[model samples]
Target chain A: MIHPFQSVASNSDGSLLFFVIKNSILVYSVKDSNDEFKLVGEWSDEADSTAIIKEKVTKEQQRQLAENTAKKLKANDGTALPQEHKEAKIPKPGQGAPPIYQYIRNVKLSRDGKWLFACTDSDKAIVMFEISAEDKNNCLRLAKRQRLPKRPNAITTTIDDKQLIVADKFGDLYSFGVNDDQPCVNPEPILGHVSLLTDVAIGLDSNGKQLVFTSDRDEHIRITHFPQSFIIDKWLFGHKEFISTMCLPVWAPELLFSAGGESSIFSWNWQTGELLDRFNIAELIQPFLTENHLAPDRFQNKEGNLIEYSVSKIVTFDSLPLIAFFIEATKAIFTCQINRDSGKIALKQVLEVPYNVVSLACAETTGELIATLDNQNSHDKNFVAFISMDVDKFHINQSKQQKFDDFINSRLSDNEIANIEQEGIYPLYHVASLRKRGEH
Target chain B: MRAGMSLDDPSSRRQSYRAKKEENRKELKHVKIDAEVVAEKVELPKKRYYRQRAHSNPFSDHQLEYPLSPNDMDWRKLYPYFYDESKGDMTKEVTIADIGCGFGGLLIDLSPAFPDKLILGMEIRVQVTNYVEDRIIALRANNVKTNAYQNINVLRGNAMKFLPNFFHQAQLEKMFFCFPDPHFKQRKHKARIITNTLLSEYAYVLKEGGIIYTITDVLDLHEWMAKHLTEHPLFERLSQEWEDQDECVKIMRHATEEGKKVERKKGDKYVACFKRLPTPEII
Candidate 1:
C-alpha cells in the first residue's frame, strides 16, 4: 500500500511547498514556467529518534529543574511540601501512558519564510528548521528539537514572529523563542484550558493590541488579551461541538471562520463577541457523507446513523474574498465568497476530485491552491493536484501538474514503499476523533 | 430498606422504594392545605434516597444537554422570578457559581445572604441533582410570601467541561468548590477539581477581584488545591485575617454537608480562599 501524504504547507510566495510523509518532511520548490515542482530538500527523523533531544541533560540542569519544581509547589502556602515532592522525584514528560511509535503530525511555515516547524509524535518534540533567506539551493536546515511536556495538538507563532506558541493535547500553551537553539528543561505553560485544546490563533484588536484565540473540545472559543493571557477578553460560545479547524484571513482580520463537528461554518468578528454569520453546508456536503463517515460499531447510534462529519482544512485566498474548505475523508472541496460590506458568506463553488484530499495550501503571489491527496487508488500513484480560480469558480488543473509526480515517485525507493506498507500508515482522518463519544 | 436483599432484585426494589418516597412527598404537600395558607407547603426531598457514589469521571461523555452558548441558555425556567419577559432577558445574571455542589447546602445558605444575586449550583450526578432541584422548589414554595429562595437553582452539568457554554467571561463574582472529590490515587491527580489548567478556566469566568472559596476534609487534597491556586499567575492567596472577616468563608466552613459530616465525626476541615488578581501587564 502507498502511504498518503499526511499534511502540506507552503511559503508566503508559494515558491516552496512542504509535504509531510511518514517520517520525513519533503520540500519542493515550485517552477514559474511549467508550474511543476522540483525536489529540493528532505529532513527525516532518523537523526534523533530518542524521546529527548540530542543534547544530554547536564547534572546542573537536572538539579535546578528539581529545585524549581519544589519551589513551585511551595510558593505561598505555609504548609510543608507533599510527600512525593519531599522525596524530590524527577518529573516525567508524559505521565500516564507508556511510549509508542507515532507519525509526524503537521508542518508549519512562518510568514517571512525564514523558519519552519513540525511536531513529531515519536519524540514529542518540536523540530525546527532555519530556511536560508538568500540560498535557494540549501533550502531547509535542521535547527533545534525542543521536547514539550506533552504531545502538541496545534502550533503557531506570535503576531510579531518572535515566539513560537505550541498548544498541546493536555491543554497547556507554551512558548519558545523562534530562533532559540537551547533545549527547554521542564518549562511551565503560559496558559491552559481544562479540555483538550484543538486549535489556536492570534489576531489584533481595533487598537492593534494582540489577542489570542483558542478553541477546545468543549465547544469554547476564548479571546484573551495577548501576553496577558490570564485576562480573558471574551468567550465566543457559538459552537455546540468540538472545534478542530480555525482560519484567520489576512484580508479580513476582523472576521474569523471556525468549523469542526458541526455541519456549518461560523464566521465571527474577533474584536467583539458578535457572530457575523453561520453558513450551513449540510445540503451541499450530504453527497460526500458516505458510509465511511459512520461511527464504529461500539460507538454507533441506536439507529446506526452516520456520525457528524468534521471539517478538516479551511484556507482563505490572500488577494481575493474567496475561502476553501473540505470535510474530512471527502472528495469535494467547497469554496465560499465573502461579502465584506454585509459580512455575508455565499457558496461559490464545489470542486470534486477522484481521491481524498489530505490538506491544502495557498500560494499568495500566484493565487493557486496546492492540495495533497491520498493517491493509493490512483493507477499512476499521483499524490498532489493544483487548483486555480477561473472567472468566478475554482478549476482543478490536474493534467498540467502531472509532471511533478515523476519527481516524487523517483525520490522514494521501492523498498521504502514496501516498508511503509508493512508497518501500516498514520491516520489520515483524525478530526472525527475530536468528537466526544458517549462512552468514557 | 436492608442493605442487601438479593432475592428481591436490587433494581426493582430500589424502583419501588423511589415510588413510595415520591408518593409520601406528594401526600405531605396536599395533606396540610389550609384556607388561610395560599400556597401548599411542599416537603423537602429526603437525602438518603438520593445518595450516589461520590466520584464522577470528568472526561466521560455523560448524557448532558447544554445551550449552544450563554446567549442561547434559557434562564427563565431556572429562575422564573428573575426573568423580565418584556426585555426577553433575565433581570439579573447568575453571579455566583457552586461547582460540584453536592446536596447544595452552600447554595441554600448563600441564597438568603445575597438575596439580590442569582446563584447556580452545578452537579454531575442525576439523583443528587434531582434532590437539589426538589429541595429548591420546596424552599421556594414554603417561603413564597417573602420570596426567600427565588434566586437559587441547580442544574446537572460537568463543570470541568462546557463551563464557558453557560457563562461569559468576567460574568461571575464568586465561585465555590466545596468538598470536591479527593481522587486519592496518584495517577488521578489530573481528575482533581483544582489543577493548573482548570484554574485558568475558572479565572476566565471570574472577574477581577473575584474570590474562590474552597473547603475540604481531606488534608492531601486541601494542600494540593492550595498549592495549585497559589502557583497560578492570576490568583493570590487570601490571608487568615481576610478569611476570618469574609461572610462567605464563615458560611462555607459550616454550611456544606461534608463539613457537617466532618464535624459529627470530629475530623479536621481545611479552608483556603484565593482572590483573582488583575492580569499583569507585560513590560
Candidate 2:
C-alpha cells in the first residue's frame, strides 16, 4: 500500500534526488544502486510545527501536574505546596499534542542547488530556503519570503538564474531579481492567457534568451519573453481543454510537451509555434487494453481496486522517447513511446502500483521513473516509489538478474549479506533492484 | 657757362628759368594757402561708433550674463529662423538656453514639442554661429534668440565658463545632452561632467534631485554614467519593480533629435539618467 504522499525533485547535477513527504524534505544520494534511499539528511517543516505544539502541550501538562500535586500536598498536610516545588513537574513523553496542518505543494531546487524554493498554501507565500550541498546537517532554512499578489498557482526560476517568475491565480506574473534588496514587484502586465494559469516553464528561446511558457485554463500555451519587456513574441495554441501540465524537453530547447485535462498530449515546436505531433492516450490505451485483457481473477488489490482509472500524470526523460503516465484510479502506471519524427505511438508497459498514484517525474540524466502514491489508510500521507522501464534496465547486454546482482554486491558487505540471507532477502532484492536502476 | 651769362642761353637759361619759376610758385602757394586756411578755420573732432570691447582673454575677470529680452539679436538676421508662429503664445512658456550648443539643429527640432518652451542657442565659433543664426532667421523663429558676445553675453562663454556666475543654484529643472565628447583618457577624466565632483555641481544648479537625461554613442560612456549615478548616495537607480520603469531608456533612443541622427547612422546609443540627490548633511 502507498504509505505516504511523496514528491521527487532532482538536483541539477543529477547526483541527488530530493523527496518531499508531509512537512519534511529529504535528499538521497544516487551513488549507490540500492532501492534503499538512505537518509543523507532531512529538513522538517514539521520540527517547527511540532516544537510549537510540544511547547503548548508541555505547558498544559505541567500546569495540570502542578495542580494535582498541590491538591495532594494540601490534602495530606492541610496546607498548600510552595509555588517553586509545584512548578518542577515535567510533561510525560506521550502527552504532547499533534502538529498543525501544513501542506507542501511544491519544492524546487535552485539551478545551482544551493537554494530551495518551497510554496505552501498554508502561508500563501513562497519561501526561499538556503541549503548546503556538502553539509548534511545544513538543512533548509528560510532565507526570504516573497508574498504574491494573489495565491500563487506556480513558481519557477529562469534558466539564467537572474530572475524568478511567479504566476498567481489571477493571471498576474511577477518577475523579481534573485538578489534584489527590495521586495520583487510586477514591472508590467503580461496579457495573453484568459484564465487561471496552471503551470509555468521557463526555458531558452531560439536566440538562447529566456522565454516563459504558461499553460492556462483556456487550453492555450502562451510563450513570452521574461521581464515583460518583450511581451509580443508569440503564442502556441492546440490543447482542447485546460492544460494541466507543461514541461520543456530537458535536452532540447525547441521541443515542448504538454498534457491537457482531455487526456491529449502534444509535442510542439515552441520556437515556431508549430504542433509537431499529438496523441490521445485515452483512445490509444483503449485498444491496447482490449487486446491484452486479463482475467478478473488475476487482478490483485494490495491497497485498492486497480480498474476504473485513467492517466492523470505524465513525465518524459531525456534519452528516451517514452512518456511515463500514471493511471491514478487503477493504481497502474504506463510508459508510451512516441515516434515524434514519424508520428507513431506504442504502449510499452503497464505496471501496477501499491496505491493510487498522485504524481510522476522522470530523471533526465538517468531513465529512472518515479511516482508519488497515496499512502493507504493514511489520508494525509503518501509514499514516493521508483520503477525502472524494462528497456531502460536492460538496454544492451545487461540482464535484469545481472544488474540486480551487481547492485547488491556494491551496496552490502559480506557480513550484511550473510545476515540478510539468514533473516530475509525480499527487502534486500527490492532495494537492490531500485538501486541498480538508479531510482533512489 | 662758368661766366655769369644771360639766362636765355640753352641749358643755363633753362636752369635759371626753372629755379625762378619754382621760387615764384612756392612763394605764391604759401601766401595763398595761409591766407585761405586762416580765413575758413573751424575745429574738427575724431568720431567713434558704439563699439563693445572683446575681453583681453577669455579666462579674465569678465562675467557672462543672459539677455533679459531678445532685442537687436543677430539671430533674426540669419536665414531659416529656428522658431515659428506655430509655437504657442510665448508669454507663458519657459525659455531655456542651451549654451555652447554644438549644432543648434537639435534645439530647433525640440522647439515644436514644448510649443511654449522658447529655446535660445549660444555658440562660440563664427561659422556654426552664422549657420544656426541664419537657420533660425530663415525659419522666422520669433521665440529663439542668438547674438554675438565678446565679454559676458550668452553667445561666447563656454558652458563651464560662467555656469556658476550666470545661473543661480537650483534654477534648472532638466538638463540633457547626447554624445558629448568623451575625451577617453585617465588624464582627461575631469572633462566628463558625470563625475562625482561635477555631479555635485549639477545637483546644486539643478532643482532638488532634478532629472539629468544623458545619452552617448559610446558604450563605455553609458556604463560610466550608470555606475557613477547609481552609486551616488543621493541618487538611486529606479528599481526594476517600478511601474514606469525603463521609460527613460525608451525615450532615450527616439525622443532626442541627436538620437535620431545616431539612429540614422546605425550607431548604438547608450542612455542613462541621474536625479539630483538631496544635499548631504552638514557636519
Candidate 3:
C-alpha cells in the first residue's frame, strides 16, 4: 500500500508481473481467472558487492545533500527572505525520511526479453538482470549492476542490443557498452543537456545511424548521435509545456510521439523532424469531465491553466503502436492507435478504472495493458489493473488505413503544407500556447 | 404549468389555484373587497411566457444548499436508508442522475429498485421543478409502510453548465436523458442539452464504465443525440442486449410525462444509449 511498487514490468505473456517493491523485484503469477497473485520469489542482486555499493552511495549522497543545504543557509545569512520563502513554500514532505535505502526508478525488459535493465533512483546505478525464460524455478538472476556518476532518469537499450543509453535527471546522456572487456566500476559521463532530461529513447535514423531522441522539462526534443551524443543533431522544439514523456513506437520506429501534461498529443517523423500529425483532446475530454461532474479547474496548473490535463505515463503495445496513456489525478487511462501512413491518430477507447495510477506497462505477449494503481485513500494501497485488447476487436484493414492517408491533401492549404515541410522539417506547433491575433 | 402545481393530474392542481386566489383575496383586504374585483383577479397570472435569461442560473435558490465539495455534502438527507454512516452500513454513494425530470415519475419508479443507490433529478423550470419537489415530499410523507422515495431528490439546476459544481470526476454510474428540450433552430443548436461541447463534461462526471440513457420521441433529435454520442471518443453505442435488458430503459420509456403523452398520441419513441468506455489501456 505504502510505496509497494516503485517500478513494474510485465513479461510478454502478462502472466508474470515483475515489480520493484520495497527492496527487491518480486514476481507474481497473475494468470487468467485468478485474482490470487501467487508470489514466485524475490529476484535479488545475489552479490555482496551490491550491498557495499548501496551503502557507499547512500552515505555519499546524504553528505552532499547536507552540504548543499548548509551552503544555501550561508548564502542567505544577512536576510529574512530565506525564512519567508521557506514558510511560504514548504510543501508537506511526503518523501518521508530521505530514503536511507536505495530505490529503483525504472525497470525495462529488452526487446528480445533476454535481459532486464533496472535503474536506481538516487544511488546512481543501473543493475543488469539476466532472465532465462526457459527456467521455471529461477528465471531471474542478477548478472551485474554498475554505479554511475549520476542517477538515471530514463534508460533503454538500442535496437541492435550492443549499447545501453541512460539519461540522468541532472540533464546528461551516457552510453555504456554491453560487452566492454574492462568493466567500468563507475560509468563515465558522455553528452549533456542544459535542462532536466525526462526521457530518452533509441532508434535508427534514415541512414541507420543510432539516433538518441531525448525530451526535457524545457520543452525540447533533441535527436543526437548515439555514442557521440555531443555531436548535436536537429532539435524537435514545439511543445509549449514540459515534455515529460517520449516514445518511438516499436511498430513505427520512424515516428516519435511526445506528450506533456497537456490535452494535445504530438507525433513527428524522427528522420525529417516533420510533425506528421497532432491530436487535440480538448473536445474529447471536456465531455468526460462534464458527464462525471468533475470540475476542470481543479486540474488547472498555475501557468494560466493552459496545460490542465497531464499525461502521467505513456506505454505502447508493440503490435499496432497502440499506445496507452494515463491522467494520474483523474485516474483515467485511454488508448489510441496511430496510423503512421495516414498521418491521423484517433483516440480509440478509455479503460474503466477507479484507482490513481503511478505507472503503466503493456504486456508484451498478451497485448494487454497493466497499471499500478493507488486505491484513492489516505492509506495509499496499490493494486494492479489489467485490460486486454483482443486482437479481433481492432481490425486494422488496409482500406480503412488507406482512406485516411490523404489527410493533408484535403485539410491543409498549399501555403500551410509548404510551411510544414519546408526543408524537410515541419515545425511542431504548440497547441496550448498558440499566439493570439496581433500578438507578434 | 402552474408553479407548485401538478398539471398531469387536474385533481391536485386546483389547490394551488385556490391558494393563489386566497392570497389575492387577502391582498384585496388592504384596499376594498368587491364582487367585480374577484372576477378579474381569479384568472391565471397574465399571459405566462417564460422570460428566458441568456444564462439561466436556475439553481439560484438552492445555492446555499449546494456543498462546495462532494465530501461536505449532507447525503444522509437524500439517502435516509443510510442516515448514519456507522449505523446504516452504507457502502456505495448515489451514482445515478436524471436530467430534466418533469413529474418525478422516473425517480419514484427507480428509487425503490436501487435502494442502496442515491439518485438525483435536475429540472430547469422553476414551477416544474417545484412540482416534482412537492410530489416527492408528499410521497415520502405518506410512506409509513415501505419507507419508499427516501433515496431520491429533485433540484432546480441547469445541469449542462453547473454539472462540475456538484459531482467529482467519474461520480456518475448512469445518466438519464429523457425528452430533453429540442432547441430545433440551427442558431439554438448550442442550447440543446446534448452536444460535443457538453459530452466531454458528461464523460468526466460519469465513471469509465457508466452508461448514458437518452430517450426521445423526436426522430431528428434522437438521431442527433445518437450521432453525437456514438461519434464521441469516450462513448460507444451500447449493445442491443444492454438496451433491452436494462430496467432503467423500461422506466425511461414509460415513466415520464413526455413518454406518457407520446404513448397517448401513438408517437414513435426513439432511444439511444452509449456506454462510457474505459481508457484504451484498460482494454
Candidate 4:
C-alpha cells in the first residue's frame, strides 16, 4: 500500500508515534497523562481552500504582534503599557492559523520534539516547523525549508537530530542540516545501489558511530560512517524481497525488525547479516478462521476480493510484536502480534477508519497511543486520530494462555521433552501454542 | 764547379731550398691522392661503373653503365647505356629516389629502371639544383625529375624534411639514403637527421611498417643511423621476417647504382632495415 501523507516521529520522552494525515503534524504525547496532542498547524497547497487565508494571517499577524510589542512602555502603576496609551494584548488561540501543507509524503519530529520535518512529493521539498512551548495550538513557527535534489521516497533523521537524511526516487541520498536558518546546503551522495531507492532509515549501529541506510532494490543495507569520508563498513543482506520498512528495536540497538513486500517480517542482527527469525503473518492467520473471513464490505468498491497487504510498522508491546498493516485497496488499519523467538502470528482485529490511511506509527515508550492519517480527510478536521490501547483489557482477552500451557504439558512425553529441550525447540513450540490461544 | 760548391754560395742555398720545398709539396699531394684512391677503392666496387642484369629478370640480359651523365639519359633511350648490344636485352623498369643525388649522376645512371617507375633526384644546392634541372631538360628524360632543395637533397634541401610531404605516408615503400653528408660534430646533434626524433618521423611515414635502408661511406654515420632507428619506438630491427621478403630488398640491392658501387668495392657494407611499426594510439 502506498501512503503519500504520513508523519513518523519519536517524541522527546522517547515515545514514538506517526500521523498519516494531510495538513497538520499531529504530535501524539504517549508518555504524558494528557492523551491529547496539539495540532502544531495545518497547511495545504490547494488554491481555493482557507489554508491560503491562514498563511496570510499568520504572516501579517506575526508582523503586527512584533509592532505592538515594540511600542510598549512603562505605565504609572509600574506595569508595562503601550507608548500610544493602548493595551498590548496577546492574540487569542487559533486566531491566525498557519497554512497546512497539501500533499505530505512523510513527516519526522526531532528527538526532542522541538523540531518537525515534513516532506511532500508534490512539492519535492522538506519543510521544517518549530514547536512553541508556550501554546500547543498555536501555529508552529516556520523555521526553514530544504529542497531536495529529487522527490523524496522516504526520510529518517539521526538519533541526535543534527542531520536529516532523505532517499529520493532516483536512488540519490541527500542530507541536510537541522539548525541552519537558510536553505540547507551541500548534499552528500551515498553509493551502492543502481536502482530506485524506495526507503531509508537512520539508526545507531552496534558501535553507535555508523548510520545504516536500507534500500528497496536489494536486501543489502549499507552502513555509512558519520562525517564526510566515503567509506562503507558493511552490508547486511538476507531477505529475498524488497525491504518495505525497518525499525530499530527499542530494547536492543543490535537488533532490527524489517518487513518485506512479501508480507513477511524478519528480525536480524544489525552488525551481522544473521536472520535470527522470520515469520509470514498472512500464512499463520489463514487456518484459524471458520472460512468465514472478514467480508470486503468495508472497502469503498465493496467487491468481495481479498486484498493482499504488507506490514508497515513492527513495534513491540511487553515483548510481543504489535504489527500495523493496511488492507489493500481499502485504507483500513489492522494490528497483529507475533512472537520473535517463536515465529507465531495472530491476526487479532482490524480497525474501522473513516478515510484511507496512508501510513501508521505507534509510540515506542508504551505502544499504547497509535496514530494514523487517512488520504481523504481534510487538513484541519480529522486527518489524524490517536487510538489509546487498553493493555489490561488485552491481557484479559488472553485467558487461554494457562489452558494452552497445560494442554502442551500434558501431551509431551518425558523422552520427547528431553529431546525437544536439547534441540532448543521446546520454547518455540510453547510460544506458538500460546499465540494460537491469543496469549503473549 | 769548385766555386759553385762553396759553402757561402747564397744562390746555391736558394736553389736547394726551392727544390726541397717543391719535392715536399709533390710528396704531400701524392700522399693525399693515394689516400683518396685507397678510400674510394676500399669503400666502392669497381663494377659499380658497370651495372648487370637484375637478379629477378631471367629473360633480359640488360647491363647498366655506371657514372652516366645526368644529361642525355632517359629510360626510353636505353640502347647504348643499359641494353646489351650482343644479347639484344634491356633492363626492367623500377622507380627510385636518388638521395644526395649530386648533379643527378646516380639518377641518370638508374633511369633504365624508370620505364615502369619514375626516377627523381632531390638536390639541396642552388647551383647544383639548376645544373640537374638543366641536365634533365637537356636530356629530355621524360621519366626523370629533379628538384633543388638544399644540402640534403640531390643538390640541396633536407631530404628528411620534404620526403614525408612529397610522398604519402608509406607511398615510397623503398627509400635509398646513399652517401649522406656526415655532419660530424658532438654539439651539432640537432642537425643530424638520423637522431631518435627523425627515426620516429620516418617510421610514421613508412607503410604498415616499412623498412629504411641506409648506406654511408662514413662508418660512424652508418652506425648512428642503425642504432637510433632500431631503438625508436615505432621501429624494430628487421629480423628473419625480411629474409624471404625479397621484393623490397631486391630494388635496394640491384636497382640503384649505389648498390652496384657497394658490391664492386668489396667493402664490408653495413646494411640494416628498421621496420616501422603500426601507428600507436596517442596516450
Tens-place lDDT digits, model 3, residues B1-283: 6543445545344555545644643353222223343333223232122222223332122322344344445565555455655775444577999988766788889988898788999877655655565556555545534656677887766675356556766889999998988877554665677876467667777888899999999999999999989877778998778889989888889988789989999999998899998744211
Please provide, for model 1 over A58-80, each residue's C-alpha lDDT reduced to its tens digit, 9 standing for 90 to 100. Answer: 44355656776767655256665
Q: In model 3, which runs have C-alpha deviations exceeding 4 angstroms?
A: A1-4, A30-38, A44-101, A134-137, A180-183, A286-307, A376-382, A391-440, B1-283
lDDT of 3 at A210: 80
Docking class of 4: incorrect
TM-score of chain B of each: 0.89, 0.55, 0.75, 0.50
Worst 10 residues of 2 chain A by lDDT: A428-437
Give the TM-scores of the predictions, in the order they appear. Answer: 0.86, 0.43, 0.45, 0.40
DockQ, cand. 3: 0.01
lDDT of 4 by residue, A134-177 (tens): 65564467777776655676777777878777777554577677
Q: Kindly report which residue stretches of model 2 are placed more than 4 angstroms away from their true locations once superposed.
A: A1-3, A12-15, A46-101, A180-194, A283-312, A327-330, A340-346, A378-382, A389-440, B1-283
Q: Model 4 off-target regions past 4 Å?
A: A1-40, A44-102, A135-139, A284-308, A316-357, A373-389, A392-440, B1-283
What's the best-to-worst order under TM-score? 1, 3, 2, 4
Q: How many clashes in each structure?
A: 0, 27, 32, 34
DockQ of each: 0.43, 0.00, 0.01, 0.01
lDDT tens digits by residue: candidate 1, B184-245:
86557778889886788899889999999999999999999999999889999999999999
lDDT by residue (tens digit), candidate 3, A1-440: 13324467887777767776534576666545534345553564433445556566566566655666666654446642342222122222265654333456678877676777887654567887777656677667776667676668788888877777888865667777765544477554555554567788888866667877888665568776656453345567567566778877767778888887567788888677677878887776553342222323544446533434555667776666577776544456778888868556788886655455667787755677776654335233234556666553432222321221232123223422122222332111112221111110
Q: Please name the candidate that would achieve the greatest DockQ relative to the true structure.
A: 1
Cα deviation of A210, candidate 2, in Å: 2.0
